[model samples]
Target: MVIRYSFDSLQPRPIDLPTEVPLDDEADLSVLDEAKILAAPASRADVERWRDQIERWREEARSRLCYSGAQYDRIESQWAQTCFAVAQVWLWDELLYSFEDHVFTPQKFLADARQRLGGLDAVVLWHAYPVIGLDDRNQWDYYRQIPGLKELIAQFHAAGVRVGVDYNPWDTQTRRGKADVEELAALVADLGADAVFLDTLKTAEPELVEALERAKPGIVLEGESRVLLARIEDHGASWAQFFADSPVPGVLKSHFFERRHMLHHVRRWHRDHSEEIQSAWVNGVGLMMWEVVFGVWVGWNKRDRSTAARMLTLQRSLSHFLLEGQFTPLVECADNADDKLVFGSSWKRGTDTLYALVNRSEIPITLKPIREETGIVQLDLMTGAVAQHLAITIPARGIAAVMTSQGEINPDMIELASEVSAIELSDDARFEHRRVHRVHESSRSKNTGESGVLIEPGEYVLTVRYRGRETGMYDGAPYVDEWKPLVPRLHDPRTLERVTTLDNPVIVAQHEVTNDEFLHFVRESGYQPAVSNRFLLHVKDGVNGRGHEPVCFVSLEDARAYCEWVGGRLPTEDEWQIAGDKQGFQRLEPHVWNWTESEYSDGRSRFAILKGGSDAQYDESEWYFDAGVRPPDFSAKLLLMGLGMSRSERIGFRVAFDRRNK
Candidate 1:
């Protein structure tokens, strides 16, 4: 549909959004500490000067046998330390999932990503390296020149996901391996990766991280390094390196009894440190993600999947609060309801606060109100339910959420600003929009504050009329809904609900809720937003800052919270179709797989049907649905199923007012 937008499309309108208080002198996009660029070896001239020494170091590493107790020399220059620091800050944004991803052959991983790992943000490639210990320049060259490796990294980058290659930098594996600063630079230079994950390192000398980043500015450094090491300014992430049973609780939750405390020597002090690990997660600390269904899926059951999902979901949902908010330990490990062990922590960013309570046991647990001085509403992330008191109940082996607001909420009393739209998807839909800031091949091209839009993505009011027309294939061109003699239930709802909203068209919000708008609801309603993977991509300072992108991790209930706050509600599935199916309404913007007030079941699991697809950037149709014999297509009748309570980066909602609700 061709729809043009111009200055005269709508009258002047603006919504006053909350302004951010400076965290430091850093205003917009000035969050990075540029003064400490890590001098000397970080510069190309100095690094090139060490080429001969680096080559000899490589030769020595290649001859070392597995368990030879031989150590390969790495660059110890201060410049190298600067690279490590630079890497840690740049890579902190990634949420790692380490598995021997079988689909990651150099040729196919990127192409199959949309189908197998659509929402995946970080990917680690393992299983291809045959040599465990150090080999010389020839072996290193052969490994670095693996065909199609460059293309895979480039594609992943284009999709906004970083790819990391796994290697044990020291001696400890079935066979010992060796790597140094020069070798690290050579590997990254040829592979085109964003990071290198050095396995089993208690401390990844800052020099190595710095050298890698010097070669690739955005290079991330990660591994099963200690928690404190990951916390360094340039250390990207770590794998549960918190001392095992040493005093401080472990943050990396082991998958089973056999594998505890990452490196075999450090036995974990106790089991089920999920609560403690979560504390680290909120602090923007990275964990080794092996107790997951990442690859092979060996010996995995539903319980294992749910357990991993719970941690990932909590991480994804609370990501904004965890990464950006300052972490405050609210409660230490304690015995709670029915003998279940519980712990609590609060991630506070400005007036917005998300309090997380985790229960580790085989039974349910409950917590009474802690801060009863003022009213607070706890929004359960697992169940899309809300309660007024601070008290909350968590499922067995599960986590729960409760957020406190610093503002008042009066949904029924909402007085919205003008320029709203009430239209179905059409060729001529009107809406307000803004493009997110993009880095043009220059890492220093922009500042952190610039990522947070100064202006809000406003609302546009457009009208949508229903069309109850029947469709069929003509000249081999398949229409939205084709009537088949044998299949009677095809294309039924459009004609059914067309008359429902015909009498009085409702006012609809034009754009998907931006991060800034959702924060308003979170701050005012005391509701928690969905912890989404996408938030990690745009969080400026551990908080959601890419305000121009559509808000994700919102549930139907969360959607209702915003609608109620704005004196509106979600559009019905029929109304949504009518808006998109409209003939001549100029479109305000492309779709992002929105949630409608409609649902269905596939004879087993119940799912909320989502409509519309991502913008052209995604290159996939949103209007796709199939049941049994029906095939995937661009049909408006296509319906996609999503777990009602779970969150998705691609799925969200738009607000609308119903005449009937009045």
Candidate 2:
């Protein structure tokens, strides 16, 4: 009687399949013994020879079919299939036995295969069972012997090749359930395998997919060909395969081949069915050459030296074809048979589109007019003479690659302004003209004499003067205190909090007027007023000629409105900082205050005020005040005092000219 089976069923069958036969049962036990003997003390020379042979074969195969597109696809499919079959068979047979006793040496096979292949891109080891030896009671003990496997892996990695392992999560000897599969997948990911070979056993494709997602999310998964193909066909898991032929517009058919024969197949297929394949799969074709010939399998003999060589050659040729234009999908097959084929990676740099072209036919072909807005194009891979116009002819089976140019901005043209000068205030005392004027030289002239010199437009360091109390009375009594403090105490908390120290030497009075600053700019310039009708009355108590009193009381619209009047605009925060004072005061002296263009308090307070003081008050303020006290309120004032003066309430002002105006 025939038995019906669902695709999802995981039940074991009554009979063991031929594919599951033990190595000792099928092959001579002596062959296993010989491998064991040879591998027992495998020499460095033995390993090198195998590596050389593999490299030589690969080089030869790649050179032979460098231009064959069809051959490349066919061999790729074959290689993938071979890897899947070998991996599955190995898992079914030899992995359960201990290499120390069974004489199934994976290292010996790898050394031989390496010599045959010339150079391996990578090696993959398939471990079928969780535990290798029957005598090994602890499962972890079986893994301790993996150091030998790791050595081989390290060798390949040092040679610029990657090494991977096949993880069979369903093996009952190692794992008993779904949870075990998950744990094993996580372990494989943690091992950092270059590639993972997954088998479809008791686990379903969906479960495998989920396991991969949860465990090794970023790692490359090399699925069994039959399992992947069947999943795509029956279970609707198209993403299982790297290349699915269904969704791609014109794909006719796809297959897997060994890497050894891929080059030959690609060339022959390109020659014979290039038109059909190109017509059907216009999105370009994908070829898979899994690592079966890398001497990773213990069940099969190492791949023939010739086979390894052929695979390398095929890979090189395919890479060259991809770089050239031959591999591009025929997006729209024109009626003209001479239409050129395009090839390109799906990567983009910027606005420019990149295209790789090749002439498949014997005759030369010229590409149609490419759009100018596509930007100027340059060939990244060109070695010959360069030209603005791409006029060179691509010979038969030759490639041409081109990418658009990226533009850059000139650094030399950007100009930066100099720092703003610090505001320095003159003494509030009377100005006296003297050739060395002295106070009390004429006791009656004291009220009429000045203490400091006058300031000119270029630059000056002015000092404020204050009166000190006399110690005793005499014809002309000498005072105990010489100079009065710069900052005077103010009764209003808001006014006192705004004062700043004179630490910053340089200060600018006014920020270059934004429309806001110029709105109050009653000063005469030759240009007609942008906003002539709007009148600004000079308030009496307000600091006049002090454009630097942190231009305030202006609306946002008014600030912007004034900028047009002065033929200048508001400074950006960066520009304002550059021009304004940055240094903190050491003492309580008010320097000339400057107006900044920045909006403070979220534009609710439309101005930023800056002040500076001397070093004497630095230690004095903390003794009586907390850190939270607002700095002396010179925010709205135009003048700032020096270190020892008592008139801190009188805020000073200074002026700044826009360099842009000059």
RMSD for all candidates, in order, please.
Answer: 27.8, 34.7
Top lDDT: which candidate number?
Answer: 1
TM accuracy, model 1: 0.38
Q: What is the Å distance of residue 334 in model 2 from its true position?
A: 11
Given candidate 2, what's the lDDT at residue 341?
Answer: 38
lDDT digits (tens) for residues 190-268 of candidate 1: 7776666665564467778667867877566555524331123344344443332211212222111111111111112
Which parts of model 1 have CA positions greater than 4 angstroms off? 1-119, 127-142, 170-179, 205-207, 227-231, 241-286, 291-300, 310-314, 332-340, 407-662
Q: Against the hidden reference, what TM-scores do the models get? A: 0.38, 0.28
lDDT of 2: 0.28
- lDDT (Cα, tens digit) per residue for candidate 2, span 298-320: 11112222222322332233332
lDDT of each: 0.38, 0.28
The Cα error of candidate 2 at residue 460, in Å, is 99
